[model samples]
Target: MDPAPSLPPSYEEPAYRVFLDSLDYLPPTDVERIKSAFAFSAKAHAHQKRMSGEPYITHPLAVAGAVVEWRMDADAVCAALLHDTMEDTGATKQELAEKFGKPVAELVDGLSKLDKMEFASYQEAQAENFRKMLMAMARDLRVVLIKLADRQHNVQTMSAMRVDKRVRIARETLEIYAPIALRLGLNKLYRDLQDTSFRLIHPHRAEVLSKALKAARGNRAELLGRIQDGICDKLAHAGLKADVFGREKSLYSIFRKMKDKHLSFSQVLDIYGFRVVVDNVPTCYLALGALHALYKPVPGKFKDYIAIPKANGYQSLHTTLIGPYGTPVEVQIRTREMHNVAQEGVAAHWLYKDDGESSADLQIKTHKWLQSLLEMQSSDSAEFFENVKIDLFPDEVYVFTPKGKILAMPSGATAVDFAYAVHTDVGNHCSAARINHELAPLRTELKNGDLVEIVTSPKATPNPVWLSYVKTGRARSKIRHFLRTTQNEESARLGERLLRQELLSLGVVPISIPGEAWDALVKAGGQQSLEEVYTDIGLGKRLPSVVARRLLAREDIQADKAQHMTLAIHGNEGMAIQLARCCQPIPGDPIIGSIRKGSGMVIHTHDCPSIRKSRSSEPQKWIDVEWEPEDGKLFDLRIRIEVKNTRGVLAQVSGAIAEAGSNIEHVSMDADPERLFTLLRFTIQVANRTHLAAVMRGLRHIPEVTRITRERGGEA
Candidate 1:
């Protein structure tokens, strides 16, 4: 047979051929169509290559193969093949539609990126990328499934790259892809992606910890095998027909368990577990009972998901057991239908033709919450992307409404997020919540199946503090939206207060800043229409100084006798004080304490903006205030030097400052990058303006110095 004609040894072929041969599970035509799609993709990506040495076609094939295992429709298979061709192969939408059909073309284009010209920032770019992915997911949920498959393949192969690139890929996988997969209920893929990325992202810890896991699995091998067989034997003895299987927990799940519960490796006892699947729900209970009798069950570790399924449609009876030799073991019992739903999630109905009331439509209705993301559109891509991230976050707590309807909510969600998820109006008008027949605060954390009642009144409105308490995106976003609408009210009050304060400082009547003039000033500011003036005022863009300056030349406005607020040597000209060298003053900063000395009442920013805010915005603080003709000798300010020293460094620094303009009073050197690192600091004389700037420029040009900034002393 020539050894099967010596295959090309494709990376994906071995795993994929298994799926291809499962033809009885799929109609022959559908299977052939999938193969043709793969062949087409191979040609399109024939010459293309990934960062890894594999043919780029292998990625899409692998993605399609994953979807096939899910038993998705032909359109999904075709879409997976053409997913990246539009973006990377210059393949037009028209060509895709003509060749593969309209649904496939639409999915491909939806997954494509926005043109580079549209983005202004990395945030905007990310948002656009998410928008594209979301649009794809909304149209064909299979798009996300395939995308996740691609991400999984990439993460699995991330180690075949450079160190920095590996970290970057792992980070993206952790931050974006893993969260999305988990949100879509692909637990197995999500776990693999997370664990694979974590291993690379923190390799050293992963290795040592992985070694411990291997040792523990080895040591507990006998106990786990006994527990598995014991459960199978007991179920058989009870006449309950079932299949039992055992597996260990993923490293990522273990790591997360450790981090969240503050448990050490040994403390995690539920790592190795077995699952039992019977033919029906009644049998599932029978199996559970059988297992319980076989081994003593652990306390407070049982869950009945069959009665109330997980948010992802996973239904099982979970019970921890104390097996032979005191080894703690876990067991899960579920019916065959429940097992399929648990493993395949929403896609299971499509594959198995679940006998229920429009299972596909029910799945869609159940996932309307996810679909609502596309409907609640935002003009700013960045905000929209952020909302998607918040929306897709996994790890949720399920609770019941007062009417007994189950509401799945994000972990740490309050009653507020629940109310909003039910209806926007209910959330906006929410006044209070009751948990388990007791009055609970709106911030009360909800647990599984707590009957929550939301109280609403006609006068109820979202409060600003709700933003702090609400954990879900819907509540936070709705609250922010409502507040933004009411900013007009905030604007008028804030503007009036600021105007009044400015009038008091100028010793003038507030009425002199006429409302008509205020309207005109607002109109000229290029804000959204007119009333936004007040919103801008509330948002702090309308400065009092600017308003004062605008109303300065008014006939009724009076000017106050205020000092120039200059600084100089203690007791020099006009009894004035110089601005403190240690601190600079800006309009938004507080001013304090008059000094009759070096300069009279030297002006200083009450709260220094330097440490609190970046210096970028306050160039005006670089002042012209001078030392009054020296009534007292100059005070020394520490100057820092950063440079390369090769002998004569101190002499060169002192000479440079003197040559450009000032006198050096003292010199000091500090330990830097290393003991031998070059850095020389000198207290130089800048009697005034010309001398100060000259010395600075001279010091700046010195070859060795890295950076020089003013260092503050103890006093103001």
Candidate 2:
């Protein structure tokens, strides 16, 4: 082995010695290279100091020490030592590449934040920085490992920071960094980050909890010892050689459970737990059997995670039992390998020095998660951050495909979420689902072991209603992307039609307008292309009349001679046009159009009071519009019925509406038991005015109904 290199005279001896000892497991060449990297980073940050007044090099050395403890590769350790060089010093990536090679340079670069870039807000900047790190993480997992190590050191040494800054960093650490550590299966680091952040964010609460935990531990020492002895005796009797360890819940975990479950501290059970590490998979189950025999097992508390591992590749058998004195005891049974994986997660691959099946499985799971981050790259930074945040805290439920392929999803995930998990196209065209061989709605929440078969149709498109219930970030982002794309395309088409109509009214041939004229319009509107200008016009952001006038500015045509043209309304225009709910205009109603910025045109009945008020206030927004022939689309209209307060009256009115071939979309009642009459409001879907009238007439036939009138002017 190569001798350790001499350090700078200013270096802290004890910290450097500890860091050097961690690299003893590496080869001589790797150790020498890492030493060279440390020398270069020390020179780069020699003059800098942290907020705690410690030498800045100490921070990088601490980060490197963490990487070594995680058993990361030599390159990752080198990158961790130089993580802040490019961001905080004059050190360039090229210099690092020439000194330590390209992989180390890339890792260091990925660990650096985008502090030099300008953003609209602090949140935006944070999101952009996170997005950049995640993209780099997708390419090399070591990038985030180094970054997490860097963050871990920063949070641990943030006592000298201002209260506001400390709170901000602690909140970010708790929300993003801690969850990410847990997702990666770095259990020790996860708990450390969470507990440190909780202490910083709420010092008093943390102190109280810490004191209470100590008192509780002291009180339960004897009982816990007895339970541990009983478990060991049972395992020994069952002829299963195992190592048993007692564990306690962390203060943050205890506080979170109490807050989330609305439980008092005294009511929290299973605060103490035990882990039994056995020889192999079969021995794990055997240990579980022995533990169950030692105590009465709690029903619905046994989970065989060994049969179906967690999304992060965690595998174990968990059971809660009623121990002596009727107290609940939690136990986890697993093999030695499973214990290593459960603790170290992806880092176990390097820690255990094994390329076994467990390591391969962890790699596959991590790869899938990284692939999802890549898939979400198209979203805006803030949106991408939110989506990733949702994914980082998943409580998973495993479901199966019809072909028997198992897929793990977040708890409360719907059929739509499953469809998207299968394939984006499947989700886009998903019409219905068959859950467990029975027809079910797309919003139906899937349970564990569900055989979910998605029904797709070529003609079916994603519904806006799906956004309300889809649980997965992938599904939510996909639906939003589809809606935005479809809306923009439809808006551009509508803009073209409106512009062409206006051009014709001005006595100009729509096709005769030169490309130069269109280019001029785009420039005037401060847009990238003519299509964008048209989209703006269609979205009501730019008035078509104003654009038409600008197009004819160079022509010798009389602008005053232009005739007004009516835009025809078709119900199938999609998101480019909306029917105003205030009036609920049907195909046969006399309607007018009002341009709503960023919302396209809204159609309202000509006599609607809301439209009248809008016309007087904003005359330029009003446009002459008329409805086209009905295309068999249903329109919703609210109707009020005055009926006697009697039993079965609601059922009778609903039955009469159904008999008239109309569907009741929603219904509500305002009643008083002391009065003889009650008012019922119904929002029903019908073909047109005639169908609505027929439904009203049928309602009048009910003996209990005194009068009926269609509601208008405002929301019912």
Candidate 3:
């Protein structure tokens, strides 16, 4: 309790000496093993010293001390002691493996930087680090946890180091580690790290931000106190046993609130709030109802998560109520269990994992994602890291199926993501949707409590256009994989066409070419036969024009194939239209595309309301293009509108879009009724790009329109 009595005067590995005594749990053998690891690391780092003039062993020992605070195991403790031995001390992996066991050495290796490996850019190096971490995370999540612990300690002492070094490390921690912590559900660590990093990286802004929050909070103190007291009184009056604890938004949460919602510190409601923890789930709703009676309930600010747990298993009943002071303050009603889940997130699973049978079920039901990472390792490290970042965002939505089944997805997830989430087969064959009984597109963004019904067919396939509209990385990645496969099929088709043209150019039809000539041609091309040649061309490694030239010279084909395979058929090289997915340009959203010649297509939300509002007029380069299909070609679109949150708000919005004959693809919302505002971003589809502009017009006609915008280029 007294912090393991700091390093003894005789301590050579002072850091480890201190750590060994501090941990609450550890066997005697484990202690000696850790100490020995510490000694070896010290010897390896003998030449190094800290900015504070302490031996380098102090750093590893310090890191190990922090790991002890997390109640980490013996192996983790030992690895913490030797974490930098391989990185800065020039200790070989073989040497560490021979000295420590393979596991300890492997952990040290994972903690080691890839500074030795050359990369194309510093960004590449950072990206690889993130990628390696995802792979490591999939294997042993403890590795990154240990790394984060190490980083937290390093950051605490960074002030003693160079200013430039402090800023660099802090910025990386802010951008990367903080996000990782949140993604992994290490809420306390994540928040603390973000604050610390903010302090170091942008100290002035952090200071100004801190002061602004304090001033605003100070103004609300009396009102918030009354609300807290009122909640306590209501709980007492109802004879419900509960603990009502006042919780203010953290500084980082406050900063994010201001930045994200474009609100001044004073303007942000729900900054002052209280959480009432009851004994059971039933009591949570009872408390919510009581609070609503006590204060006029703010419309559309209510969320019932007890019936619908978050992707991370957080459950609560949240509502904003207009209080005695005429200001709307939020009250979160949850059972103690729910409160724990809300704060600890996945770590809360450890409480359930304690019981043998429950632990198995917990792992089974909860860790489907952990298993997915292993499957995801088929991707490269950077790609894997990108996936991790995508998956780690904390906001999520819960929607119901017609049969009463619930699906938990990230906040921005579209129907496309939902399809892939349900099953790869379902995603591939998704043809239509019914949200609470109306047809919707695969890109539909679902809201909490919507009864979503996905319609599938054997005929339909994953639309490549869904990539633009899909929000979740899982859906995006799956759509990409399908598209890649589709591209291969297209390429193979084109390749065959080119081959026939080459034969024609030589004035030799495939049937007319004699067996001897074909065989000679195959041999000259260093291939097995004509099939191999064709396959290579299909795979894109072989050039059809080159093959045609060789065939002409050797009399295999004529020179005219060059003109037949003419890729230059489109004379005026225009930037082809490729749709941006942020707002799919279905008949419902604005659409634009800037041609990047040579690149087939690029798309943007038509007159992105955000951009249109940001700029006075549409820019000159907003080129127009239509969906080129003979029939309807699905166009993904994003439609964002500020609407009043009320009963059937989502259904009404979806209904309006459905009335326009477009399908809802994906939808998301950031709303607090206390502010009389909710930001809803939606993705849907129509016959072509033309349908999107009409959708925006329709959204504007909706009564709740504070603003509606599409994601387009030029403004952002």
> Could you say which candidate leads in TM-score?
2
TM-score of each: 0.68, 0.95, 0.70
Error (Å) of candidate 2 at residue 352 is 0.5
Which whole-number lDDT from 0 to 100 does residue 434 have in model 3? Answer: 85
The true-versus-predicted C-alpha distance at residue 380 of model 2, in Å, is 1.8
> Model 2 off-target regions past 4 Å?
1-6, 554-559, 643-659, 670-678, 696-705
Best by lDDT: 2
Q: Which stretches of candidate 1 lie over 4 Å from their true place?
A: 1-43, 115-120, 269-272, 354-362, 372-394, 492-525, 543-716
lDDT of 2 at 287: 86
Candidate 3 residue lDDT tens string, 1-716? 01122333536444444665686477876776776776677667878888878777778877887677666677888888888877787888888777667887778778888989998877668878766665665566567778888888788777788889899889888777886666555677788898888788878888998887777778777777777888899889998889988776767777777899898867764456778889987888788778878989888888877776555455678898887757777778887666655665444554333424422333354456666644444345566556656776677887776667788788878877777777878888889988878888667788877777788999788766786777766776676677665654544454565567656645557676567766776899898667667656655467665676566466344344423322211111122223454444443333454423223334545555444542345343233434333454555545667788666777778888888788887888897849577878776766654566666677677786767765544222
Q: What overall lDDT, based on C-alpha atoms, would model 1 receive against the true structure? A: 0.68
Candidate 3 has what TM-score? 0.70
Residue 563 in candidate 3 has what lDDT? 39
lDDT at 549, model 3: 58
